[model samples]
Target: MNEQLLKDLLNQDLDPVETREWIESLTAVIGADGPERAHYLLERMVDETRRAGGHIPFQPTTAYVNTIPPQREAQSPGDAAIEWRIRSMLRWNAMAMVVRANRKPGELGGHISSFASSATLYDVGFNHFWRAASAEHPGDLLYIQGHSAPGIYARAFLEGRLTQEQIDHYRMEVDGKGVSSYPHPWLMPDFWQTPTVSMGLGPITAIYQARFCKYLEHRGLIPESDRKVWCFMGDGESDEPESLGAISLGGRERLDNLVFVINCNLQRLDGPVRGNGKIIQELEGVFRGAGWNVIKVVWGSYWDALLAKDTSGKLRQLMMETVDGEYQNFKAFGGAYTREHFFGKYPETKALVAHLSDEDIWHLNRGGHDPHKVYAAYHAASAHKGQPTVILAKTVKGYGMGEAGEAQNITHQQKKLDDSEVRAFRDRFKLPLSDEQLADVPYYHPGEDSPEVRYM
Candidate 1:
């Protein structure tokens, strides 16, 4: 969970004293029965610097100090500077631990051994599945669920299809000195992301957001013979008028080989609520009425909930009969998995992913790709549409990040960890991967598929 979550302040946005006033108000609203209710507001102050990318706003209310460590624990000039190097290594390895913990071997195509190196968790997850499956099933073009057209664009950038420098230029730096990344420093995201933040809500910009998808629809970006496109966009974006218009037009114009993933973060602004979080359910209703092939996957908090509910017979009916495999390929991706509960996910390659021990499962499907559920929907849609498929993944926001709440907290970013803290986090969270262990880990190539892969 080595990332931040955004908290949306409603009604009146506060500043310092004003913020304190609101915290008191919120505390009252939460009432005495709610334990530590004030913590949420107080917590906001600790991470202000993260608000605009990294232009740190100096630590919030002084009262926050007790709850969190001092931001400027002015050490003796001799002490803090001296430990900087050691701290840096720890931070680097800590990040690597998160990366490694997230992926089994080969998920990222190779043993990056460090998050400090330039690879994303999505990349790791996608490649891991691809490589693992390729060992058994060759010729499967690695199909993926994109969170947004930008995500697909980002993948293209990662695959060496785009240069690092260009992507950096395209990206805006949120922090003071732009952003700094390690392990192949140049491979930063081409954009800075703030929750629910966007350039515009207009059709043109919506179209821009859906840009890569247009290429996907027209068979413009990819080669037709190879596998088609799998595009991922967030839940909010799923409802954009322009996106819907594009899909309708594409369908009317006969766009094939496109897979859409509407990642349901269960949110509107900060995020959607639990239980009824997915946006696709509504969209599915519309798409189906239009004679479009769509599959709806309402999954549970763990793989078991999903697998238990998703009996093989139901899956066959969904994939083989519902949509009738119309387009040769069409799918929807959704499930409840989160990294918090199941980090370093390596699900049992057998059908009983539901029954496996917590230790054996590699996925924490809080919100990420669930190949089984998603691919089943893809099968259904592909068969029904008579066109290749779009596996629209309804996923959770902040899928792999540390914070589990809908609010991506800014305070949790570990900019620095003293000796005691660093040691503890290391021992508790990140262990190391062995050479032999690494060799057998899942490796991500591309277009690889597996029916019996373990999924926890």
Candidate 2:
């Protein structure tokens, strides 16, 4: 296409028919080598127009973006209010964890990023599991990966379980620490009930608990329906031999009341876990072979439309074939770097995602953050009979911690949040307070009479 023709297309407001003709003409000029080639040529033409001081009209469209579920969107006033309240709670809970960690130095509550993701995942499962099984008889919640006790603490604090004084004294370096840094069954309050001895014991203990429940049921003690146990473990924890060692017991005992929710954050304390890209696949095989049901929760709805367009399966390959290191780089560098690295690895994907903006790609669906998907997976696990169920939920290690820790390998031990980062966090969450007010009342309570506060 000549510079003159490009200028003409950019200058005039064309009708739909005229725009279609322009596109055809441009396509013919570029030759139908492939959709990628045509797209590249068009982009090059647009860049040339911009360099020549002409603004090419690039109208953004959601056609390429996945339509999020109605629950995810605030469609009505009530919906918006509720959504706003939820977001505030998440932000508040996250900040409370970090701030408390910062205040009580050497107490080691600073798994802010992990705690953030953990809180979200637990929040979704808590309501469902509580209503499904716990309300009648006390259900077991085993904390296999106990480093995230602060996350649960934050949630409990928000829900009025922890008093302002209790929140203030959490993990204090001094004598009288209200809460332990790790999830200790004897230390923390309700909801965060069970504690594990070591890294890989969650599933093992859960299986035994379910078996014991079966024994009780057989003896005409507790009902079989109230025998549920939910075990929360991390991806890194899954690597331990003991993690899968007793998993066979579930099948042998037919512990249908047992459920394991694996937080697949893709990183260990040292670095990314081995076979990172294939951990879920490997776990699926192990569980299936052991006579258990496995549910792999990977990408969210964001990739649905894009994947549907790729009939040849190249995009799917790109998604699965990319090494774990590449995903680490994506979290470290952000969208532009990942786009270049990802497309460079699989050039065939250019045709699939070429039209998408950097923001669109960056905002791709993550299963951990999607409450709907998490809730659904929990519901499915609850309903499954015979063998136990495992939910492999994909999540970022340091999600929502901003550049401080998100997806960074070293985030596991990253406990301190600096002043500037704290400010940014506060602003991002839109807390209704000034810096002075935030400092004055770190544990601000909503008005007692307010429905929002009462509801929480």
Candidate 3:
């Protein structure tokens, strides 16, 4: 098939059967050499499908990266709570922009893209700290990265802090409509995210907030408590001079009440943040030198078995040594590409993962996506004393959305998803409601009407 014809076919909102037919036809003509080649082609076909729908391929907008929640039957009460919150956060991230008027011109509407991957990474820490805080000892969140506001709003909405009407009016300037911006702390009484245009201000602000708490306690103005000031920022944001300029202040003041959660998705708005995956390691030294306790949370459950099997820590070294850009390429290119990159770069590591398929290697768990790892990091941060803490959690941008936006260089600008793509996304989360039902539902509802939805 010609490129134009392929694009045309992909643009159409074809059902699964038609999509398969087109794929089969293309493979027949292309002469599929093996299952891996066919799988790669299938991925390319999906990309075309997204492009046809006006959703830019490899973009990081909500339409491109907002995906279904990962399937996990909760293992414990804590796990169940975390899963419920994560699913709720994902649902809101997906529905937030879709409810807005896409036709609006200029920059006067809900954001086209929400920081889906970044938000999910930090949600575990956010939920835990928020739940534990009380009116007397109030813990606050310092949002360093501006793009992640939607996920914060999603968590708030599920926690009953926001009403359905308010959610429906998100980005609308009308009297009760949720006033839209990257983030506005004034809109919410309890939260304290000041609207910031640049990166690094969050770290500075969080340090000041922590210092203020200390001042209040010393003066007997407030009771001494374990309340913390949690700041969330991207590793890309760390490259900004403003982000790192205030590092010394945290250590100088001995702000143990401060906690920094760096979402190491490793991609800035432009491209990969670091060539090798040493951004975390590099930051570790910077923070430690500046007098902060740096905690690295890399490798999720997927690496558990592999690590357990490694007697000499070869797999861990391979993982750590894998370049960040190479990892992004693996994600953008898919399973076969990752297998080739991993095994090709380190021939000796092949024996460690040889039994696994290309698909298995590609599907390895990321630290940010794994709730258990995130919670554990947060728990450790809370227990830490004497110095400020930083959790360097590795993550994937456009993580769950599949081929449309994961790890692509162009994710920041692309926006909006077509109907079929939306339906498929819902199905992945097991929220397969009919078009009629979805249409009839209000912008925000109790969600009891649908088996899988429950955000209203």
In candidate 2, how many clashes are counted?
A: 0
Per-residue lDDT of candidate 2, residues 265-377 (tens digit): 77887688753465666666778778887776676657667777876556776766766666777767877776788855665677677888877777776676666666667
The candidate that achieves the highest TM-score relative to the unseen native structure: 2
The lDDT per prediction is 0.34, 0.67, 0.64
Highest lDDT among the candidates is held by which one? Answer: 2
Which structure is stronger by TM-score: 1 or 2? 2
Each candidate: RMSD: 23.0, 13.8, 18.0
1 or 3, greater by lDDT: 3
How do the residues 1-456 of candidate 1 rate in per-residue lDDT, one tens digit apiece?
311112223234445456667767877856864545566655675566466466654321121001111221112212223222222222333333333333434332211111211122233234332222243332222222211223333344434454434323222234432222221123343332211223123322322333344465368563323233344444455555554665554455344534454444444333232322224445555554444455444432353454444433333233222221111011111122312222213233234345555443433342223434433454444344344233334443332222222123221222322344334433443334333433222112122132111110
> What C-alpha lDDT does candidate 1 achieve relative to the native structure?
0.34
Q: Select the stronger candidate by lDDT from 2 and 3.
A: 2
